[model samples]
Target: MAWIILLIVGFVGGTVGSIAGLGGGIVIVPSLLFLETSLGVISNMGPQIIVGTSYLVLIATGLSSTIAYMKQKKVDFNSGFIFFIGSGPGAIVGALINRFFETDQFAGVFGLLMIGISLLMFFTKSIKPIGIIKTGKLHTYTDENGMSWEYKYSTILAIIICFFIGILSGLFGIGGGSLLVPIMLLLFGFPTAVAIPTSMFIVFLSGITGSVTHVSLGNVHWLYALALIPGAWFGARFGAYLNRKLNEKVVVTIFRLILIIIGFRMVINAIIG
Candidate 1:
């Protein structure tokens, strides 16, 4: 029964995460905790195991979405790789940091993070992009309407920002795309079309590093990951398609509310525990 529930959680997490470019780990981590602590549907999953398992599932989610976006020529591999330069090493350090926290403490920190991300999503569009710098690596995107948009960024600044993003990813088992997409838009001046897919590419790379670190530390719950992987992969593909077809504002608004609710719940639970 728990495994069956995990399948659905994975599907929903993957679909929502991919469509939003946030990665499924946000939903996966909280859902796992809820199942373990609230419902007792699963047993013996500590914060470390939950985080490790979530990152493992994110590998599938990120890969599927990235592939789908790539087919549409939406992914910016050059930028993504550059961002990974700092993120990869940062992820290693974050995973190490994650090793110290037990359940209640981790829950409090993670809950606050989820709420912050929720607010970020809510205000995504209203937040204006940073003014064009015109002094760094310039990139352009041509929309279906034949409008051309160009953006630029300092490689050094991008790498520095991504390092902190990677720390959050590895520490929290989130895709960090929630953070990455905005930075790409606000700081790097990436067009939305390019930013979303590029964010997923970075997620995939970060997932690899985060997963490897967790596995080395024996933080993962193999059975939980097994239950989640297949659904997450296919759901991400479906989500990528939906992302191309639908207006994202509605989806993002609703998802932000959900994250807020879940975040507050986790925070309360941690306090009570």
Candidate 2:
């Protein structure tokens, strides 16, 4: 019964996450805690273990979504690669450091981060393409649906931003997409379509790195993570499909609302627990 609930949570998380480019952690982490508190299954599980398990689940979610996005030719491989260069190592460091915080301390920090992201998303305007494509520095591409996009950004700047995003991902087990998507859109000038898929790809790499570290530390609960994978896999593909059909503004607005709600919940949980 508890496993069933987790599977359902995974499906919902994967669907919303793929569409919003926020990854499954936003739903998976909190839902897991809710289940544990309500069902009393895994009552001994600590927050670190929960976070580690979330990273494992994210590995599956990211892979499924990336494959779907690749089929649509929506992924920006070059940009993903650049972001991974910094995020990959940062994830390892974050995972290693995660054990240092108490459960409530981690929750407080995660809550604060989510709130910051929510506010940023709420106030930010839609991003437009820069419209200039340099041969080596900037590039233009068309998606499978025939929409074209062009973008230009500083590689150093993106790397620095992604490194911090990876640390937060590793620390909180949120897959870093919540931060990455907005930064790519508002700061680096990526289109919503491009940012969604590219962020997933980067999350895939960073998630794997963080998961490995957690595994080495024996922080992962394999049975729980395995249960989440099947639902997350199918849900991610469906969500990616929806991403093509929905209005970008609508998607972002919904994403922001989710962040605000989840952030508030986390803060309250930390305060009361």
Which residue pairs collide in model 1, if any? none
Best by TM-score: 1
**lDDT tens digits, residue span 161-188, model 1:** 8999999988989878888887787766
**Each model's number of backbone clashes?**
0, 0
Q: How far is candidate 2 from the true structure (C-alpha RMSD, Å)?
A: 2.5
Clashes of 1: 0
Candidate No. with top lDDT: 1
Model 1: lDDT of residue 132: 57
Q: Write the per-residue lDDT of candidate 2 for residues 110-196, one digit (tens) a residue.
A: 778878977877755543434333333766777656777667777877788788878888888889998888787766668777898
The 0-to-1 C-alpha lDDT of every candidate, in the order given, reads 0.88, 0.82
